[model samples]
Structures are given as C-alpha cells and as structure tokens.
Target: MTLTQRQAAYEAEVLRRWQDQSDGAHDLGHLRRVWRNCQTIALAEGGADTEVLLAAAFFHDLVNLPKNHPERAQASRLSARAAVDWLATQGFPAEKLPAVEHAIAAHSFSAAIPPETTEARILQDADRLEALGALGIARMFYVAGAMGGALFDADDPLASHRPLDDRAFALDHIEVKLLPLVHAMQTTEGRRMAEEGADWLMSFRSRLLREIG
Candidate 1:
C-alpha cells in the first residue's frame, strides 16, 4: 500500500521509536505485516476507515510493555494516548482522532476491549494474526528463550495430561493462546489467514511430538 507523504513520515517516525523499545517479534517488520493484513482485510471487509486502520497499525505497539508486566493490558490504552498526542503534533485530522485512538486501544488481547468500530475490529484481527503462523512459532521460541521458558514439557508436549502454562513453556502457548485467535478474528480474510496460520502451528506441534516420541 502506498502511504501518503504524511503517512510515510509517520511510519518512519514510528519505526525509529520502535527500534529502541520493541523486541524482535514486535519490530517494524511485524508492524508492516499487520499493515498489509489491515489492507487486505479492509478491502475484503469493506466500509472500514482505512486511514484510522493504517495509523493504528503504526501506533498499536508504540507503548509495548513486557509480556509479563503487571499492567500489560494497560499498554494499549497508553499507546492510544501517546499516538493521539503525537498525531496531534503532526497535524492529523481532528475529526478522526477518536477513531484512530479507538483502533489502537482495542487491538490488544490483554486489554479485553471489544472493538466497536470496523477499523478497530480489523486492526485487532490483523494484530492477532501475527500470533498464529510460522512467525508465531519463531516468536514463541524467541520470547521463550528471552524469558528462560522451557521449550516444552518433556513428558507432555501437547499439555494433554497437564495444565497448560505458557509462562513456563513456549510450546504450550499455541494451546493456551494462539489456537483461540482463530475464533476471535473479526474479518473473513483475517479468519482465513488465521486458520491457515493455525494449521502451520498445529503441523509443527505434531511434527515435534512425532520426532520426540
């Protein structure tokens, strides 16, 4: 998608800020992918506020907190505030600030804010889609290694016999969090992409189990 000159400038600024704050999985690449996902889903879903969606895409992770932070759910709300403040300085349209803030604020799973606008729904789905596929697997392990989480439970890789705990085991994350993303998707395109990604996740888990067994 071709961003307008102003939008491009915003993207650059967002990327620059993220360089210092975001981890590998939530970096610029992830934002770009979510932007692409928003475009695709918006086109398919229709009647979405594209401008709000795009801006929210860039601003969604602006205040990314640690995964285990006590106030992790509040990160999206803080990001919304930061984004609105920055966009005001950049001359963003006053009329659209609420929509943009809503989209950014509603995108986080931990926030538990139901998406009221179409743009917010698309942004949420796009963000959640990031947690499903091969990239999801890579990110799962990346965070695991960072947090010193075990790769899997040695005796129960699928968590069939044990309570799932993603905080302690990376592989259990798919079961605990990623799989539920499929049903949570708001757009048709988003749901399709999420399902495909979930398939890849499931296949990897199956392969791992086979290899280990």
Candidate 2:
C-alpha cells in the first residue's frame, strides 16, 4: 500500500479502537488536533520524521486513562506498548518502530519522561500544545465537568488563600499546571505558540477575576 493509503487505514483503525473507549478531552478529535500540531511543528522545526511522528500521535493516547487515575503517570508506557504491538502486526516500518515508541512513551507530562529523539520531542511538544490556547480552555472545562470539578472557587478564584487544588476546581489548573507549560514546550515553534496561548489564558484570567469581583 502507498503511504497515504496506509495512513488512512491506520486512522480508521484508530477511530474504531477509540470509539467506545474515549472521554471528551482524549477523544479522536483531540488526536486529530495533535496530529495537525505535529505536522505544523515538523514543517517549522525541520528534520522531524513525519511517519514516526504521525504514528506516535495516533497511538499516544491508546491507553486513555483518566487524568485523575492513580496510575496516570504510567498511561504513556502502556500506550507505547500497545502501539508497538499493533504496529508490528500492521507492518509499520520496523526501523522506525523504536522512534515511534519513544515518541509515544514520552509525550505525556505525567510520564515525566524526557524526549530523547527529534520525533519524540516534536510529539511531546505537539501534545502539550493542545493543553493551551482557546481549545485548551474548552478542554479544561470538559474534563473538569466530567470529573465533577467546579468552575472555580467563588471565594478565591485565584486560589490566593487556599491551596490550589485542580481536583476540586478547574480554574486553578492554570496556575497549578498550564501556565508552567509555557516554558516546558520541547520545540522552538511549540514554545513560541505556547507563549501566545499563555498570553491569551492570562488575559482570560484577568477578565474572569474582574467579572467575579
């Protein structure tokens, strides 16, 4: 099969596997966005292996554990294993399998695995990029709602008094985690994009605080 045909088949299979098992924030749509981010980053950064990046993107969330799962940090490892097994059966390039596996394994923030290869770094950056900007705001609320987290703490929306607990309130996630990602992005393009997204998020917080007051 041609590369394009192979990718189409992979996309279909990925959708099938995910159809029954995905949550709002980690669904196929999220994968598509991440794939797009990878494409954009690869073009801008240069020297990234597109096949490995695309494979990693499609399979990175194969395990799809909830964010609050006790073993959340291990999800990426499990996803990597599953992707490798599936790709082996599909005749995905044997030479590139290790790169694909590494990229998937290191993509998760919770995994805390530093990406070692260009493909891995780009994949990591692409996935994290999703957790910023306008869509990031929407996704944060989607996850918070699913987890039964409140929009924010009315008494301390900025979490000045109480300990910041994203487990209970969605908005606190910005300061607790999301804002810090601005500096954590792995690629130059990703960092630039992250800065812009962080700026928007900060502006959003200002508007929200003023309205709450």
Candidate 2's error at 161, in angstroms? 1.7
lDDT of 1 by residue, 135-206 (tens): 889999999988889999998888888899998999999988999999989888999999999999999999
Per-model C-alpha lDDT, please? 0.89, 0.88
Q: Against the true structure, candidate 1 has what lDDT?
A: 0.89
Which regions of candidate 2 are displaced past 4 Å?
Answer: none
- Which candidate tops TM-score? 2
lDDT of 2 by residue, 76-117 (tens): 999999899999998888999999889999999988899999
Return the TM-score for each candidate structure: 0.95, 0.95
- Residue pairs with colliding backbones in model 1 are none
Poorest stretch of ten by lDDT in candidate 2: 1-10
